[model samples]
Target: MKRILIILFIFLLSACNDNAAVEELKEDYPEIKEVAEQFPESVQEKLAAPTVLPFEPKNVSLTYAGDMPGNPKRDILHTEFIYGDGVGVNLHVTTYHNKNTTWSSDEKTMKTVKLKDGTEALIEGDAINVKQIRWKKDGTYYSIMLIKAPKVEKEYTIDDVVRTANSMEY
Candidate 1:
């Protein structure tokens, strides 16, 4: 009877630990966890979502942008997080499975940054002030862009975008 009691106690402790883990995941990835179900299982396995954002987005959307041309197995996914009204801040995140291709810019403002995990990323902006930070992990390329419309008052810095990249959870 003592062995049976010990086994029951262990099972209860493990159940509690599992619940705590789930709760922690939900806390860290509330928005992503809510929307992750919309993706197919294969995509979900490859997808990494940001645990932090520059702002609290009023709207979040995830879209499957179809497979690569000529190669039906490679997929493209896009996610957008929007804050404020018609002409406000828009953060775009895109991921695709493409091992052969990487992106770079010739703009004078372009620079490279090292992420917390030692991955290299590029940040670039055009004359119009649109900025993008891009990096690759495990043959998957990821990009985050900050689009501030003409009416928006605040200008998001490259550091903000870099922070978003650093907070990605795989």
Candidate 2:
């Protein structure tokens, strides 16, 4: 119940795409708002805008996850690439132009790591739990979230997340 309430609170906060927030985001991420104006004719076209992982785990496939048009919490071009099952890896790719590179993720819960390409990344949570790999590359942000389920046999690691993040091609 506590977890549900927390999640609901976050959802409410994120869904508060009120005029003020939208205006603030327009100022904060103007490029994203510009892109939003030119949002592709179709969601399929928008899905084609993001860089994809060059190397994917066996049996894992990419899917077109939808977007929230006119979202005000952040003005971003969002494309999601789900690498395995919903119980496996959920990669969220967000493109926006902002000087603020920091994410809402709690720094206390994340450990910083340096990627092979010399880029800095944050590993959220713990390795044995639902971990996420977050990094900013070439002005774009990539978040690789690992979802472990009871029936899922595959066990993912931080290395796997980093490798997948590294394999992304813009």
Candidate 3:
């Protein structure tokens, strides 16, 4: 009976530890209210808060990385998801602020795709490689970018990235 009790105690402790780890992972996702201030002016003008989250992989967690502040090339916001123990996927969302000139110049090298919603999307690189998809809606220029991730454990495919973009509600 004493041996059984010792084993039960060990099992309970291990289970509790796993739960704590999961909880810690969940806490990584920042509260929108708290991270709102990190958004660039153009993004703030367009979105009340950056709350669009795509379909994340099971056991993978997503966390807000805040706006890429002070970047001269673009006004961007970022979210990072991690899974497979250490692999990460960074999602970058950018806005051009209703500028036709900028949009035209930037998308010069990108292939154009028509989304189901009739939105014209400009894509750089295929789903298998690093990619950036740009589109405009209601005068707000937006982009969904997947940076090169470490090829360890599990890697995301192009279809995954496209699905992530389509999952965007706002």
> What local distance difference test score does each model get?
0.65, 0.52, 0.52
Ranking the candidates on TM-score from highest down gives 1, 3, 2
Q: Give a tens-digit lDDT track for model 2, residues 1-170.
A: 99999999998886563334223333555653554444444322232222334234333323322344554443334544444443454544433333454688476676878877898888875456466777777655667766565465666677766666665543
The estimated TM-scores of all candidates read 0.65, 0.49, 0.51
Cα RMSD, each candidate = 6.3, 17.4, 13.2
lDDT-sorted candidate list, best first: 1, 2, 3
Best by lDDT: 1
Better candidate number, 1 or 3, judged by TM-score? 1
Whole-model lDDT for model 3 versus the true structure?
0.52
Instruction: Give lDDT tens digits, candidate 1, residues 39-102.
Output: 5556655665676788776665555565543555545444333333345777777776444554
Clash count, candidate 2:
0
Clashes of 3: 1
List residue ranges in candidate 3 displaced over 4 A.
1-31, 37-45, 48-86, 98-101, 104-109, 127-129, 153-155
Off by over 4 Å in 2: 1-77, 86-102, 127-129
C-alpha-based local distance difference test score of model 2: 0.52
Clashing pairs in 1: none
